[model samples]
Target: MKVRVLVSLKPGVLDPQGRAVHHALEGLGFAGVQDVRIGRTIELDLADDTNDEAIDRMCRQLLANLVIEDYSFERLGDGESA
Candidate 1:
C-alpha cells in the first residue's frame, strides 16, 4: 500500500521559509501573492493491511509537531481508501 503524510505548520505559527519563498516569487515578477506556508510530504510503502489508526499514530508521534504543526494522511494505491 502507499501512504502519504502531509505536515504543515499550524495557523498563527511563523513560517520563515515560506516567507522567503514568497519574497523570491515576488522578486521574480510574480504579483498578487498574499502569503505562503511551507510544509512537507512523506510517502510510505506498507503492507496492504496497514490501517489508518496506525498511520495516525505515526503522525501524532513523529510526523507532526503537536504544538506548532498539524498533519494529515491519505492512502494512495490500488482500490484503497482511508
Candidate 2:
C-alpha cells in the first residue's frame, strides 16, 4: 500500500522560507499576493494489511511535530478509489 503524509506548520507559526518565497514572487512583479505557506510530504510503502489506527499512530508519534505542526494522510492503491 502507498501512504502519503502531509505535514505543515500550524497557523500563526512564522515560516521564514515561506516568507522568502513570497517576497521573491513580489520581486518578480507578481502582485496581489497576500501570504504564503509551505508544507512537506512523506510517502511510505507499507504492507497491504496496514490499518488506519496504526497509520494514525505513526503520524502522531513520528511523522509530524504535534506541538508546532499538523498532518494528514491517505492511502493510495493502484486503480482504487480513495
Candidate 3:
C-alpha cells in the first residue's frame, strides 16, 4: 500500500522558511500575497496489511514533531500515483 503523509506547522508557530519565500515573492513584484506557511509531504510504500495504528505511531514518534506540528495521512490505491 502507498501512504502520503502531510506535515505542517501548527497554528501560531513561526515559519522562517515560509517567511523567506513570501519575502522573495514580494521582492519579485508578486503582489496581493498574504501570509505564507510551509509544510512537507512524505510518501511511503508499506506492506498492504499495515494498520492505521502503526502509521499513526510512525508519525507521532518520528515523522512529525508533536510539539509544533500537525500531520495527516492518505492511503492510496495501488493504481494511484500520488
lDDT for each candidate structure: 0.91, 0.91, 0.96
lDDT of 2: 0.91
For residues 1-82, could you state the per-residue lDDT of candidate 2 as single tens digits?
Answer: 8888899999999999999999999999999989999999998888999999999999899999999999999998786643
Tell me the TM-score of each prediction against the true structure.
Answer: 0.91, 0.88, 0.91
lDDT (tens digit, per residue) of candidate 1 on 1-82: 8898999999999999999999999999999999999999998888888889999999999889899999988888676652
Residue-level error in angstroms, candidate 2, position 31: 1.9
Worst 10 residues of 2 by lDDT: 73-82
Q: What lDDT does candidate 2 reach at residue 13?
A: 93
Q: Summarize candidate 3's per-residue lDDT along 1-82 as a digit string, tens digits.
A: 9999999999999999999999999999999889889999999999988999999999999999999999999999879996
Candidate 1 has a TM-score of 0.91
The better candidate by lDDT, 1 or 3, is 3
